[model samples]
Target: MPSLELKAPSLELKVPPVAVMLLVALMMWLVSLITPVIALTFFVRLFIGAMFAVAGIAVALAGVISFMQAHTTVNPTTPNSASNLVDSGIYRFTRNPMYLGLLSMLLGWAVFLASPLALTGTVVFILYMNRFQIKPEEKALLNVFGEAFLQYQAKVRRWL
Candidate 1:
């Protein structure tokens, strides 16, 4: 019988997700300059964008608080430093609330920019994080937490 082997992702966790988000935001700005703006009122855009940003901040903070309460490392770059498996609080719903929060912020930025092209940054961020950040983190967490991590993974969606 032949064994199935998974090739390691080349960029796995090499770039910090926060940095990627910033770069994507810059790119989004450039793209927005070259694209037509969406037809949205200024007040409408401001309100919608602010709502998303606030929600993102809240969600990300919840994840951080959960990790802090659990005495686990919140640093995504060093998943091995995590001392505990946190599946409670916000973690019970989404496996990567931090990343989802960042995504929400990007969405809010896109809406504020009112450029359809700016939305592409959100998509790019998701792809990059999934490949380079989240997947690697999941592997490390599984290794650290064993079946417990697997069970948590099964119960929670990666990003909601």
Candidate 2:
């Protein structure tokens, strides 16, 4: 009989999610300042930014509520401590609602800045999260929750 073997991810740089969000925000501000582009009317920019911010906040709050209900750890650095896998509420639509919320907020910031270059911040954020944060967390989750986690991951989209 052959045994199944899963290769472990090479985990590196475990920064807390809030810190990453702040760093990305700061970089977005720098990008806006350095490469200003696409001027829009005040009300238009405000409206779009506000819309994104509101939606992001709503989704993130829902995630928090679900995590609380499930008594799971929301700490991005410690997925192994999670008591339950929250799949209800906003989670049914997106696997990482909290991260999605942060990304959406970055979009809002970029729109508010009205800079095409600033918008790259959102893409950079997505890539960075996928590489440094999410991949490690996924590995940890698989270790802790095993088959159940894999099934949930198969059904849910990482970001939507």
Candidate 3:
């Protein structure tokens, strides 16, 4: 007799995080087209959105820079390729600053669109990234870095 095995639905690291972010942005735009905008002045929305966008860019860039300095691969799809574990710079705050930064940019896009419905994309993006991208990356990292990775995970929040 053959043993029966159950299989889980997988989305693990198949899509690039940036591509996911862009797709979410497109969905947000589509939602904005049909939804009513929030009652805010254009300038106010632009200023706030721009602030979020700038902050997101800075945080994401910091993560990339830290990886570069450590001579590690910044490729999220290939976490196993990392040469060294990075615990400095923005990484000290959130373990996944790049994802957080992308989320921030999506939030900025939602604000700029002024559509309440568009904000839903942020939630979707977070859930998707958490399940599909980050989980797999963390698993790979745990394999590569072992105890050190566990210690880092204990110290840092996944997202902030």
lDDT winner: 3
- Candidate 1 per-residue lDDT, tens place, 103-124, comes to 9989998999999879989999
The TM-score leader among the candidates is 3
The per-prediction CA RMSD against the true structure, in angstroms, equals 4.0, 5.8, 3.0
Candidate 3 has its poorest 10 consecutive residues by lDDT at 2-11
lDDT for every model?
0.90, 0.85, 0.93
lDDT score, candidate 2, position 58? 88
Backbone N/Cα/C clashes per model: 0, 0, 0
Minimal lDDT window, size 10, model 2: 5-14
| Residue 112 displacement (Å), model 3 | 0.3
- Tens-place lDDT per residue, model 2, 1-160, is 8757543334433777768888988998888888857879989998999899898888888888899999888888888888888878988899899999988888888888898988888888898889878887888889988998899899999998
